[model samples]
Target: MAGTSEMIDLKSTPHSLVENFNLMKGLLATYGPDELQVLREKAFRNFTEFGIPTTKDEEFKYLSLRALEDGRFAPAYGATIDRFELEQSVLGPIDAINVVFINGEYAPELSSAHALPKGVFIGSLKDGFTVYEEVILEHLGKIANLTGKLGSTNDERFVYLNTAYLTDGAFVYLPKGVSLEQPIHLIYLSKADHGPLVSYPRTLIVLGENSDAKLLESYLGMDGVYFTNAVTEVVMGESAILEHTKFQQEKLESVHIAATSIHQSEDSIYTNNNINFGGHIARNDVNVWLDGEHTETWLNGASVGLGHQAIDNHTRIDHAKPNCNSFEVYKAILGDHALGVFNGKIFVYEDAQKTDAKQTNKAILLSPTATINTKPQLEIFADDVKCTHGATIGQLREDSMFYLQSRGIPKDEARGLLVYAFAAEVLEKVTIASAREVLENALFAKLKESQDMPEKGGE
Candidate 1:
């Protein structure tokens, strides 16, 4: 172990995680070959070096891992879930190829049985390495690794943890010039049927040149006290386009941590829409490196927090090449004693003269006790660039509420409609019709659950 816990006290470290990591190593290492085992060992060094991050760590300042440190959560490598239940639970209002994973392990029997495109490949990472070993080797760690450009202090802290304990996850690959008419839905079901559990979900997606695809991923907690630490890596070839949407609908007792790393090639376009509605403690981080010129990126997110839950969104867009354009918009709705945090940073390199980046973060608190902390930042070394960042935090406008109530709407209806409209701005960004429908339902459903919201702070 190279980097041990130097920040937090060793006595207060995440003992359970250390134990689980050691236990899973011997068993899970057999899934992959020796090459991967060597890589896993290398990652373990980074994990021990950084240790589990504490609230004191700037990267994890807003969210605390005290709960995880206090309790012992065994790793879930295999779990049995009902097939019909998976369909009724996660496949709501979507007709697409469904890839189901239970407790981080791929469930092939439950996945879509239809035939895929001639040149496309979709299966478990476990199977991908067997069938497409060359592609897996070339791009897996290239986009996201413990010792590489992608391995920043913020990434090393948790990403290495996932790598050290990783088992099996989804793997998707699309060949050049192939566009699937239907989308791919990845459903992750975390079922702690036995006791408290922790699952680490890993994914790697590679899109070849001039290809296009739409992807949907959802994290669901069937029912139990559990934690999910998930990581996704994307490799986009020149002129490739991908539309990705993520839905976080875990149980309130579940904690969810998600991180995504993307590498864009020239003329590539990547758009992501994140909708967070559940999880007792949910934090999502998305980092995009526009390494190629003429690349366009759009990052949008909407989060709804109620009760004593907490939601945090952190994103970074690195403009490494010139002539790149990136747009980011994030919105949040908090009620009761919940908390929301957003930190978005955009960095432009010296040679990235034609970089045009814009970021906007807005939040609405529906209760006097609800709290929101937001920071939008930009760092530019190029003088001939257009970069702007702004954040707004406030409650519902009285004038707008009055306008709605004076017409035909009641107070509760008016308030709900206002909140709905506020969130719809980002929800409308979902391009897939079925996925948008699912998000719309979750948007209004979460807002309704936040009813009886203690009056908006000032009145």
Candidate 2:
């Protein structure tokens, strides 16, 4: 690391990621400046300066990175995967134009982008560097840089890592006044049939003025003890409307870390729904910056943690201009010894006089051993702004459970029903019918499994 005085030795560090820096640099050498080589160099330098984050870091204070720090995972390069198996993991109906990536590399044979509307570009980031260099160069890594926005922090290091290893993910570009009738699906699956592996999936979306679109970014795994470090950046032009949904369902043995940054222009609207049901250790960072007046932003998230799983959701919504409106609601259901963490911050700058922002986080603990930590904060510098934030952590209400049980429902069934109702609030916010249906089914299935476990005193 450059900022730190001590040099981290790749040979001594457990599961050391620095060992692959040479390989990554070699890969970058193959591309010219037009292909993002310069940006990659800058990001790699930042990663080296910051180094890997530890539990001691405030941003990662609750979650431990030991699994990622100690486990040796080879970079997934040219890993083979079955298309049929990939198809089986689609979240919704298989009719939409889907862009599939296996092991962090774009697989055109498994993707369906042929039916996209005119003036809408959907393809791989690797190709976007060459085909859409101007757009990629303008937006890529601009948000990942943390110097001016959030300041120096360990959480930003992951973005630097993704920028350095940026290979192939999804790229969507909508020109002015274009509207897509069907949603675009970007599917990323990590299948480590070869061995323990690591992959970086990067996505960039640009929507021009008055453009409208819906996009789904899904991360899935097919039986692997691997690591997924993914980053997505979205830029919305004036009067643009984008409904974005992110679903993470990696295997229980894998580790997943993701960062999504969205920038909105004047009078634009951005709605996001994030759902997590898998991954042994998962952390999600979502940030939205409202830079223009009259912009609207909505964020809703739901996570289910069972067994010893650990899931964390961190979000920030910045109201930089006047008359901007933002709302956020995040819910979680934890069972067994699982742990869930939620930290949401809403910021209203001095010039954002008419900003209206609200944030709420709620969690339900199903077992006595299950745990949840939630913090909702609002920083308002604008005098006329309306901002409120709150969080609640508790188990299901005994009276509600008793009422359901008195209505002839079994104890397990009553518990399951309560859990479903609590989680469904966020799932219902998903505007995509197909995606909502899939999430509803997955939520219940998880609740049912939790209900089967032995009773705990928390109930």
Which candidate tops TM-score?
1
Worst 10 residues of 1 by lDDT: 145-154
| Clash totals for all candidate models | 3, 2
Highest lDDT against the true fold, candidate:
1
Instruction: Give the alpha carbon lDDT tens digit for every residue of 226-313 in model 1.
Output: 9898989999999999999989999998889888889999999999998899999998889898879999999999999999889989
Candidate 2: which stretches are off by over 4 Å?
Answer: 1-15, 32-35, 90-92, 150-154, 451-459
Model 1 error, position 358 (Å): 0.6
What TM-score would every model get versus the actual structure? Answer: 0.94, 0.92
lDDT (tens digit, per residue) of candidate 2 on 171-266: 899999999888888988888887788899989999999999888888988767899999999999999999998989999899999999999999
Candidate 1 colliding pairs: 3-48, 3-49, 4-49
